[model samples]
Target: MTVLEIEYKTLLNQDEFNRLESRLAHVKPITQTNYYFDTSDFVLKAHRMSLRIRTFSDKAELTLKIPQEVGNVEHNQTLLLPEAKEAIKTAILPNGEIKTLLVQKGIPLEELLVLGHLTTIRRESQTSIGLLALDYNQYAGLKDYELELEVLDAEKGKIDFDNFLEQHNIDFKYAKSKVARFTSTLKKNDQ
Candidate 1:
């Protein structure tokens, strides 16, 4: 399946996450682990793309995200346990639309390699403007929180998000994708 993901992402500290979670106690949270992949030289990152195998409780999915004008265009395919293991072990892009898209973009399948992993505890609630998500993520012995408003309508979503922030008195700032942030950390540690 393909989707156009239109969302605004902002960084949050532990205190903010705690307060937000308390206020959103009615929403149940789900935990998922994302194993990300890229070439040793970071070909996917250079292309502003990402590939990952996301494992939930009973299912796993391989997803590819490519930069788009409005938002990131995502292509996802379901994967069985064996396929997910083999793909991670060999750093091979999964066979399907995601693989085809990568190949079309001139990213050699063989060069793709496992980058790192991150786990997120996510809670979501539906709002008039869009879906609101509070994500607490951990990777590489580091932890952080993020707020995302996945908007169906960009203009309205923006207006709603701004008002939401103002109403909550949140002065948080936006950041790049989780993959990008983890990749940067990996690079810094390597040096």
Candidate 2:
């Protein structure tokens, strides 16, 4: 499955996170574990692409995100329970759209490795503006909160995200994608 996504993100401080969580207290969060994969040399990073197997509850999805002019093109495949477990344990991606795309990009399948994993407690709500998600993520001994808006239009979404923060008197903080943050933290820890 290919999903065309336009997403905007902002970092949230602890206070902001709590405040928003209170506002959305009616929504429930699902626990998700994300296993990131890359070549030893990080060829995927050089290509500005990422591959991950995300498991929430008993379901797992293998997703490859490729940057686009607007947002990203996500190639997602549903993985059976056993396939997901085997892929994570062996650090190999099962044959699917993601693998084919990676091979096309010249990433060596043999060199691919499981970099690390991140766990996120994520709550989502559908707003008039877009689909809003509040995430508390833990990885590499680090924890952070973020607000993400997934919309169909990038420009409008940006405007809406900025305005939402401004309306709530929240300062916009820079945030990297979960993969970037997780990989960077893991690299520093390895050093």
**Per-residue lDDT of candidate 1, residues 124-171 (tens digit):** 998887899999999999988999999878788888888888888788
Provide the clashing-pair count of each candidate structure.
Answer: 0, 0
TM values, all candidates: 0.94, 0.97
Task: Give Cα distance to truth, residue 56, candidate 1, Å.
Answer: 0.9
TM-score between model 1 and native: 0.94
Using TM-score as the measure, the top candidate is 2
**Candidate 1: C-alpha lDDT:** 0.87
